[model samples]
Target: MNPAPKSWWGTPRTITETIDNRKISWLELFSDLIYVVIIHTFVENLTEHFNLFGFITFWVLFLFFFNTWTNMVLYFDLHGQNNLRNLFFALLQVVAIAITATFTGEAFAGHYTGFIWAYSFNQLIYMYLYWQTMRNDPLHATTTRPFLIAYVVGEALLIGSIWLPSLPLQQALIIISLLIFVSTVMSEHRNFDREFKQRQIPFELNSAILERYGLFTMIVLGESLAGIIEHMTAEHTHLADYTHFGLALLCIIGTWMIYYTLMDERKIEADRYWPISFFRGIHRFLIACLTLQSFFIGQTLGTGQLVYYRGLSLVTAASLLALLALTRLPRFNVQPLATWPTRWLVLGIIAILILQFAPVFVGLLLMDLILLGIGILNWTKNV
Candidate 1:
């Protein structure tokens, strides 16, 4: 006799399977609004000084804000019942994220212990919700258990480290944060191992996750663009400097064009054959590149730092754009020398380097031309 079909609540679901049910939901996209505020707050903090302690604190707080929201979204996307209660919970989480952003500076200043408390509390609640979801419908218990433990331990160390009240203790907090990051990463590996062994994740679900990550990348890019516009409006009384304004616009457009031409939609769709773990690793790097680039842009605009006119900013942007291109290239098995696109990218970098010592206007002009050239080339090639 054939085995009876399992009930919906009885059969365990893989992470990928869960995501496929609701790919790119409105709720997920809308939830990222809070992060816009958080990024702004980070920029404000960085503008004050390049202090070591302040930078470290900014990184930790930024990561915490990002990771907490990401984990929550991942959990709900996988396990939420799509009911009113869960919806409310998600909304509450957004509010919590905004609150955390508001107090980030104070927390760094060691004045707002309440913000720390609130952050830790929200994390605990998030973890508890995940545990409840697992209890109700346990799937990949080995992966989930380790992940939860890591989450708990990380939060504990984070909260505990805050109370040390000494510089040594503060330094130790940074170390503990690194450990937390390691544990979180290991948990992902554990999840992948279990998924591979069980053969539960599907191609669609993997695509969903990657696409979600890409949307976050868009958020960072948009934030950077907004910062530039805001700075120009507030600082430059003469909006008549159409040349400088046009170059800035070209730079932004070029960055977007180069990145999207290489990967954007294609990368997400290619998740079926690619190892999800490897894809995630590549994504982390991509996000880092985008974040750093955004930071550079914000620093440039906010401070009038002219780093880009010199070669440093241009090289930095080129290196990141090149890395983004290379990630896409690997999947096609295209060797660097054999690829004209890569050659052009390298030439662009070299030009950027040489232009560093030139007049700022000259450097800007060259960058605009290079980006426009790349954009035109990619368009012609139908990339």
Candidate 2:
């Protein structure tokens, strides 16, 4: 088939290859920096409210930002081109996201005005992008329709939200909009399974998409790294603080090792809907828990709160268990948990949970040791 002709404005690149073998462009990497800033702002906010309510708030906000990022990622991965038009819209998104970040710290409070407008504008931009993608890439119109419709409805809700009298109403409006958007995306992806079975569409996973996920995970893990640095740089530290520092460092490093060991760059045939949906669901939880652990680790080190300490241990255990679940995805390259390492992971989870009842420092020490042991086992096995 002949490629779509470029308009005076621009056109999306055609899908010439079954496997999208393109490298992630510099623009894509640059775009991610804005999201990193957003994550940093939210992390700081999480530090202030390090309780159950705070966690819930952070998770909600995280999902909001994450959904925005995911939409852009899919658009760019599937249809984006490194041209003047793409560059123009990409910069516009950055500015909008930066504006959203400014109001994100207090989005549910008095600052909902700026957050709502910024997010609404962001959705409008995406609406245009997706609409144009469908026009320019008629081959995947079915794939693009759901996204465009979701954005349109989401934008309507966001715009209509401005008329609401109270923050509670506005918050409710925003959450409902997100829920609708997610439901639309999920429903469309479910169609992918049927389409794949009938050979109506080619729905294979690509390396570029996998690489993007890995990059996002690395950026999220930086929150924990920042916490480690915060601990190291504090003044008036004692030997116990030093011990806590060592354990925190080991735990963060071990987390990184386990993640990479399991989520290596192995392409999967994401033809069926459920496997891809489950892969995404697990990753969202995994990253959210990892970010939560960063704060819990910091709070445990500084304030020595039993709640924070327990949170640290439990999230760490849950993260590893999540990785174990990822290994079970049939289409994913990683096999089901190896019996030997599976035993260690189970034992580690149990030990880590049990040790939380001990003194903070003692529990942290034992938990870190177990994590490091599991990490070593994973690394050596892969080697």
Candidate 3:
């Protein structure tokens, strides 16, 4: 696309866009920094209530957050003009994230009016940005309009839900809103193949998109890394505390190995066979699991909450399984999980889950061992 309009507050010229450069710009990094704050807030909320309903709420809010973020990323990938207008909108996104984070608690408590308005406002800007670009690229804009409609109606319900005195009614409204959001994703993706085939709108993935995805995944895991660093440096002077902290750090390293092993560039063919929705879904789940693990570790190390140790094992094992699914190894180049090492790892995760229900420390020890086994498998594979 030609540079965003030479004037302030104008759309970019998409007609001339080509696949020449694919590096993450400084501005994109700045924007992603803002996104980390949002993700952190979500994690804190999820761990604040470690129950089934809390998990459900986390997933619901996550889908909305993911949708808003994906649209913005796609827009910039396609039509970013990199002018004051784009920067200004990016700043607006930061504010929107802050508002959502601020009202996260109330939203979960059924006082969602402010949160809905904030979310709706964010979606509105996304639509406007597309509208600006759509003047030059109607086909792409048309493909995204369904999502725009869904956001509008969903926000409207969110606003109305505020007046609902009955808790169940408010919950119903939110549920319906979530369903609308789901439909938007499904509808747009369902038509994407047809739209791309018929319209020939120069849609293709470059290495940078994959790089961005990987970078985002790293950012999420960085939270885990940060927690580990903090715990190690804290004043846990007793021998047992020191030992547990060391084991926790090892598990964090193990989590890193699981990702770098299966998701290395050797395994992921970003150019082909990667469906965006699936890719995003797996990454979201991966982030969720890691976030849970980090929270559990922090709680254990901070308050000596040994009870959360089993929960930590569960999410760490869950993350391993989810990452394996994401690697698509069985269907793609690598051999299936039936491989000896991989099979034992799966069995190991199951064993941890069942055994954790035994004496808590027993489960925690086994979890750490399983992680160490994974790291060893990769590190010594050639040896």
Candidate 4:
């Protein structure tokens, strides 16, 4: 095969030069299957400890996995070989993720060993793939130098922390590991502009990458749907169960309506400017919101009377309100749904706060109404 026609080589090789040619490969989609299982496992754990500390811890654990997956996908888009080498690393990532899944339920409790090793392995795979690209393309390596350093050191600290038997010392090590992980990721984004500027060919976000985020959101919605069906199929489900279940599905649909309507590549591309910060923050927030919404989904599925708690109401409301706020980020101004109805969203959030203290019956009814209102707003073009 020829190297291609006047190829300068660098800005993520694509399969075609046609105007409408950006497409995600089957292998990329196939790699996302493990995430469903990973999300499920993490959610199950979140339910186990619904308190503040547990909730915070759950988010932390989730970010670790979320960050790992996000970068892996981005890396593939930049430098996926599409051969046995790619397959081998992708499979390794799955194995690592599966092993990490085994420990997610109790990552901080007692199974840190498995979690650390698996997590490190995942990071290692990213580093190796990156190193390959770095060796072949020196400029690419230079662009990612900080990330490479932070990732390696972070993995080492994570692994070493597993050995310290002292509870306090181990806890400190764990915190350091998290910092390292976060620092590297931040650096990667911070340095992206430098890379883009230096490159003779400017890098642009394609429909395919944005679509990847949209597809992942769909997977999460599927998880919410599963939660709804689980409750609907329960034995001797009461009217409350049926009602709540129905509302849950409707809420998910409402969310779906708002999200799909706004998540358009054309709109995003039409923006006055595009920054890595915008993409980074928007995508991260959206992904986090879906997981939080799943938390609400599990809560809504409580079939028996007296099942819903104030905490559940509060959390569910926060998820919706947070999502609405995220959609309004200035970076997303191109989309129609990005900024309208802020006042209404505020009211919806207020209703959720009220729901936090109100009875489950009252809460679900109010919640669905808010969702319905947003759904209507999103469905039509009117303000």
Superposed by TM-score, candidate 3 places the C-alpha of residue 114 at a distance from the truth, in angstroms, of 2.0
lDDT (C-alpha, whole model) for all candidates: 0.61, 0.75, 0.68, 0.66
For model 4 the local lDDT of residue 245 reads 72
Q: Write candidate 3's Cα lDDT for 1-383 as tens digits.
A: 23433567666657347436657778777777866776677667766766777777777777777667777777777777657778898778867866776777776554677777788777778778777676667776656666666777887887788788897898789889877865576457656656655655533445566566667777777776677667668766789877777767777777777676655553332222235556556766777788778778766666655567777877877887787676545433333443665676677778767865765555566677777787678656624
Q: What does candidate 4's lDDT look like per residue over 215-330, in tens digits?
A: 88888888878876875776334676666677777778867775665454433432222443455555666676677677666665663243344544555566555556445655
> On residues 159-254, what C-alpha lDDT tens digit does candidate 2 reach at each position?
788789886797688778877765566768755555456545455556787788888888878877887787678743587778777777788888
The C-alpha stretches of model 2 lying farther than 4 A from their native spots are 1-9, 15-20, 108-110, 194-202, 331-334
* Candidate 2: residue 203 Cα off by (Å): 3.4
Residue clash pairs of candidate 1: none
Clashes of each: 0, 0, 2, 0
Give the TM-scores of the predictions, in the order they appear: 0.80, 0.90, 0.84, 0.84
Best candidate (score: TM-score): 2
Candidate 1 per-residue lDDT over residues 213-307, each given as its tens digit: 76776776786688678767776766545456566667667767766665544533223334433445455555645555566555544544566
Best candidate, lDDT: 2
Candidate 1: lDDT over CA atoms? Answer: 0.61
User: Model 1 compared with the native: what TM-score?
Assistant: 0.80
Clashes of 1: 0
Deviation (Å) of 165 in candidate 3: 2.6
Badly placed stretches (over 4 Å) of model 4 are 1-20, 188-190, 200-204, 266-275, 303-309, 312-317, 320-326, 331-339
